[model samples]
Target chain A: MKYLPYILKHLRKNWIRTASTIAAMALCIFLIASLQTVLAAFYGTIDTAATDRLITRHRISLAEDLPMAYEARIGAIAGVKRTAKTNWFGGVMGSSGGQPDMRNFFANFAVDAEPYLAMYPEYGLTDADKQAFMQDMRGAIIGPALAEKYGWKIGSTFQLESIIPPYRADKPFEFVVRAIYSVDTQKYPNHARDMMLFHWKYLYEKTGQRAGVGTYSLQIANPSQAAAIAKAVDSTFENSDTQTKTETEAQFVASFLALVGDLGLILNAIGMAVAFTILLVTANTMSMAIRERRTEIAVLKTLGYPSALVLALVLGEALVIGLLGSGLGVLMASTLIGNLGSIPGLQGFGSVAMSAGLAAGMFAVGAAMGLISGLAPAVGAYRANITSMLRQV
Target chain B: MAAVDVQSVRKIYKRDSQEIVVLDGLSLEVPEGEFVALMGPSGSGKTTLLNLIAGIDRPTSGKVIVSGTDLTTLSEGPLAKWRSRNIGFIFQFYNLIPVLTAVENVELPLLLTKLPRKQRRERAMTALKIVGLADRSHHYPRQLSGGQEQRVAIARAVVADPAVLVADEPTGDLDAKSAEEILNLLQTLNSDFKKTIVMVTHDPRAACRAHIERHLDKGVLMTTVERHDVAAPVGAR
Candidate 1:
């Protein structure tokens, strides 16, 4: 640690060179963290799965529906606890005069409410709340995050009138916000955060569209029994005009992401490139520093500083530089994630909160940079002869 | 016991299969607490002999022993430690670390010691006092005159209390007055503190002050003179 002051002094003396090199390291680290944020946002979605839940959709297409009567037959399965259904409900908000609004929110159709609640208890609804939602025909629930996003209040008649169309772009559906809830978990069981749901009967009866339901959300009696119940649900719809495909909610979430995003490989490639660039810049700085000090290092050796101590000093210099640079990078990266992640172009990925895992990974990378930077200098110092070194002056 | 023992020591330089013999079977000895001048022409292997005795270089063959430890026997790590503790080197060009102030250069050797920072500072000041440059301790080597730089080099050399002081022409780069002052300081360190001093030089006037003068010719000590001898031919005059 005594060497720390010496290192700092050297850095200050070579201010421009040292500053530029550190800036490069910081930029690379910021890039790495930025890429990781994107990957984390996408992976965070898949991780928001519920084992007790299963999704039963059309065998051939996600847009297709089955008879609402199948919910009861599926619920009757030995390991099935509950079943409900929802339509895709793709209506986005439209401003007056036929112009589309920019805000994005989840829109879903539901008839049997209890199963949706049972399968996704992370929605933060209690039994009493479920009973209230079940009893009210015009009742609607929204996540607090979503409520805040759209300025909706409980007991207020919020216009889905702008967003949800009644089978035509010319008409709209409206609802009264009955409850605003937050998911108890960090991730949502269905939408992570941006979701709103209500009684499907209101939309179903008006359209006179009796195409059954788009998808059944199922809750199993036992998590381990999910596979058997999924089989039963598919078996029930097997012979019908529309067959079913059922999967655990986690698998469902993954498949949904696979269909919508190219994140799996993109995140990995971006992460590797970021790490590699940082390594290159740091190694270059270290090489220059060592090369310039060949004679000074020889002086220290002749002065009897142990070769190992000299090596440690160089490594410590690199570590301090890396930690400062990367720490600054993580600070900027977290801000970008928190403030910018919910923009219209970035909305589906949700907020990017800095996690302990990310901090630990950055720390390990910083230490590895230190080790890499010290290697060549240490070898050079070890090989130098004290007499010739003194003669160098 | 001899503070330095050079026995059949040979140093050769190889450049593209050519052998340049800097020292061929050179041998010399110096007992404790003696002020010995190794005088010769520029290519006379004087500095080479000093380096060998200072544990800074290995001979091509044979042995160099200092204070009972065989120089060629110790590995590099131990040899560097030994040099720092036992040998104080004064270079002709002063060779002060440019980044360091006078006091810091003096403190360099103590960095290898277990002394506390305050104590190292105190000892560095005392060494500067020994060279009469305690007032210039804050100035960097570049700011000092050639003589002052040499004095700082001397402070740095003695700061760690090494057993032997090896000066390869300390006054070589100084004016006559400064050179005389440097010679007087070296004499004091010898008679007053009983330090073992070895200096290599071609200057006969500076050579006149040493308690003993030794000549290295063709990698061999030809003679040792304890006092000025009028009958002998002048080595350089």
Candidate 2:
């Protein structure tokens, strides 16, 4: 601790090199943390899935729709409480050519609003909003992120063109924004905060094409009996034309992620590559710094500093770079995560965040990067022969 | 007892397969409170002998002792501790750490001790005062003149109160006037503080300031001369 000034002064000797090395490290940390946060949001949806809730979908694929009658049969299964129906509207707003550009897209769901809202207590919907949405056939409730994005107020009306073939209206469907829903982004992934949900009956009355629902979300009375109820629900529809697959919400989300490819492996591979690059950069800089100070190091030895202390001083310099660089990077990531909705093209990741545990882990990675990078130079300093080094002077 | 003893010391260097002998069967002794100068040309092994006495290097085949400790027998760790306690070294380059202020450079050797930082700092100031550089304590090496830098180096050397001071060309890099001032400073350290001093220099005038001058040729001691007239403290004359 008493030798800190000596080490600090040495770092300041080449401020440009030191600052660049630290900046490189900070960039690596930011890249790795952002990639890891994306993976966490994907996997976190599974980990935080409701234990007592289950989703029943078509056996062949989620793209195929299931009849609304299936919800009643699933609700009759033992340990089943209630069921809600939902459909992806695939709506594109203000499209001149009637084509869906992803940039102008927000997830819109035609849903049995009461049961769906009851199943997700984390959404924090008010009774007034729910009653107003129930009274008007064209009323709609949008996520706060979507509302802020389009600058929609409670009484504002908008038109959406259906992208799906069967539900495409000759004249665009009009609806009034009844409420802007609130969600705790820290507690839930951004998917819920970046969506709009309206009544499924309105879609049926407007389109006149009853294509049925995409899935049935069932609330189970007991989490322990979820597996049994799922099995019973699947067995009841075994011989039907649209066979159903029932599982806990967690399993459903996990399978959905699996279909999207191995995100965890991809993210980890990127982190390792970035870390290796940063390690080489920092090591090269430290080697150059130490090489330039060979004579001064010899002088220190002549003053009776042991090889061990020399090693410690060199390593301490690298460690400070690592800690400071990573700290700055993580702080930047936290700020970006907090204001994700305001950043264009990053609005979908409004719920992507760095947790306290994940932040601690990132700091450890930075420290490890520093220690590993410093190892070779520190050893060189330790094994330096004082007499030979003095001869260089 | 002799403050320094080199008994039949031989130092050899190996470059590739060639073995070069820098010192062959060298034996020398300096009694307590005596000042000696080693005078020789380049490659005469004067610096090599001084390094041996300061415990910075080991003899190849013989024992070297300083301040009651057999330097040849001590391991690297203990030898460093012994050097810090008993020997102060000055170089022709001044060798003050460029990043540290004058006083900080002087305080470096005391960092090896258990003294509190405040006492170390106070002692460093006193050493700077002795060299007449107390006002320049906050100045770095590059900011000072060559002569002032050497004074700071001298302060650093003696700040630990080592029993012996070993200098290799203490005035080698200074101009004529600065060289004379540095030689006078060394003479005062020896005559007043009673420090056992061994200096290696090619300058005849620097040698004349010491109590005794030993001349070496090709790694062998050839002559010893005593000069009593210039041995008094520089202030007295």
Candidate 3:
């Protein structure tokens, strides 16, 4: 323990090298932890998806819309308790009326009011808010994150210009905010906090599209019978022109993320590459430090410090640097993600957190990195010939 | 009993299939409290003999018994432990750990003992005071002059109160006045503390401080010359 001061002094002797190595390690660890947290957030959404709900989409592709009539048939299925239809409005809050740039764009879904609220109990809304939303045809429920972002209070009106017209060709679709909804950010972190939903009847009436429904979300009474219910719903529309694919909500979420590419594989590749680069950099740094300290190491041996002690000292120095670098990196990553919640486009996605288990895993990686990087140099010092090393100076 | 016993020791090295003998059947003895110097030219095995006596290296064929323990028989681990307790070494370059302060360097060997931190610190301070460098104890090696660094090294050597002090050209790197000061300090350590000193130097002036001087040539002890300065040996306290 008394040798710690000496070890620290040795590190400080080559301050520039030590600082650069630590900086490199910190940057690598930050990249790794950030990538891992993003991957975990994507998977966490899938993992926490409601198992009692099932989604029925067009079998060919999600872009293909099914008939609105299928919602009634799917709702009448054996175990289904309620059903809701949603259409992706694909609207952009345009540059009109002093709005900011294109970054304010968010998901706007036209959904059936009563049935959608019934199917999604995770979205916590007050009874008064629900009543107001049901009463007004032009009323919209905005996520709390979205409401806070655009400073939209209940009763405030906003317009979304449609990117895919003729929902709004010359005039934007105007919506009065009726409710601010909140969801379990731990589960639906990217969804309920960044989305807006108005009445599907409004879109139907304005666009005069009577039979189009993008997808149907069904809630079943018996969650264990979800597979049977999904199979039955798909079989009902099998031979029809608009074939349907039904899956449990978790599987549906997983498939949706799959469209974004193989997130897990991509993250793993990035992580391995970063770790390998850090290992090389750290190993080189430790090698240089050991090479420079040969005489000091020999002096320690002459002072009756055993070879094992010498090896441990070298390894301990590496461990200290690794821990310092990794700790700073992870803390910075967590802080950045935590504070990103207020950013316009990054609202709900900012809820991605550094879990305790992930932090512990990163710490283990740091320790292993330190030990492995220092191994060759520590071994060299341990087996060094005291006579030869003494002659070096 | 003799403080150092080198009994027919030999040291050899192999360099890429060629055999080299650095020490060939060299033997010597020095009684307790006697100051002895071994003088030889470069590659004459003077430092090799000093290393053997300090138990920092092992002989190829024979025994190096320092203070009654056979160093050649002890394995590496045990030899380190024995050396920590019985031997203190000074090198030509005054090998003080450059990063450590003078006091920290002096307190290093005492860390191997069971002494508490306070006791170790006190002993190190006492050693620095003995070498007249107590005020410079807080300074690092780079902050000190060459002579000051050697004084710190001497303090480090004696801090653990080892039975024998082996010095290999301790004054080799110093100027004339510093060299004389170092020699005087060594003489004080030998006479006042009754430390058994074995120094290796090629300087005749440095060798004159010893009670007995030995000459080595080509890995062999050639002759012993008695110095004019003689004193009765002090028994161990």
Q: Score every model by TM-score.
A: 0.84, 0.89, 0.92
Give interface RMSD, per candidate. 2.0, 1.0, 1.0
Clashing pairs in 3: none
- Measured with C-alpha atoms, the lDDT of residue A18 in candidate 1 is 74
DockQ of 3: 0.67
Residue B35 miss distance in model 1 (angstroms): 3.4
What TM-score results for chain B when candidate 1 is compared with the true chain B? Answer: 0.93
lDDT of 1 by residue, A90-200 (tens): 545545355544445354455556656655666787666667766777787877766777788877665554243434323566767777767655355334566677877
Candidate 3 wrongly placed segments (more than 4 Å): A91-100, A147-157, A166-170, A182-192, A206-211, A261-263, A339-348, B114-118, B228-237
Top model by DockQ, which number? 3
True contacts kept of each: 0.46, 0.46, 0.58
Candidate 1, position A319, lDDT? 79
Q: Which lDDT values do the candidates have, in the order given? A: 0.75, 0.86, 0.85
TM-score of chain A of each: 0.84, 0.89, 0.90
Say which candidate scores most in lDDT: 2
Q: Which stretches of candidate 2 lie over 4 Å from their true place?
A: A90-108, A125-133, A136-196, A209-211, A222-241, A259-261, B231-237
Candidate with the larger DockQ of 1 and 2: 2
lDDT of 1 by residue, B118-224 (tens): 99999999999998899999998889999999989888888998878999899999999889778888877766676788999889877777768998886777778
Point to the candidate with the largest TM-score: 3
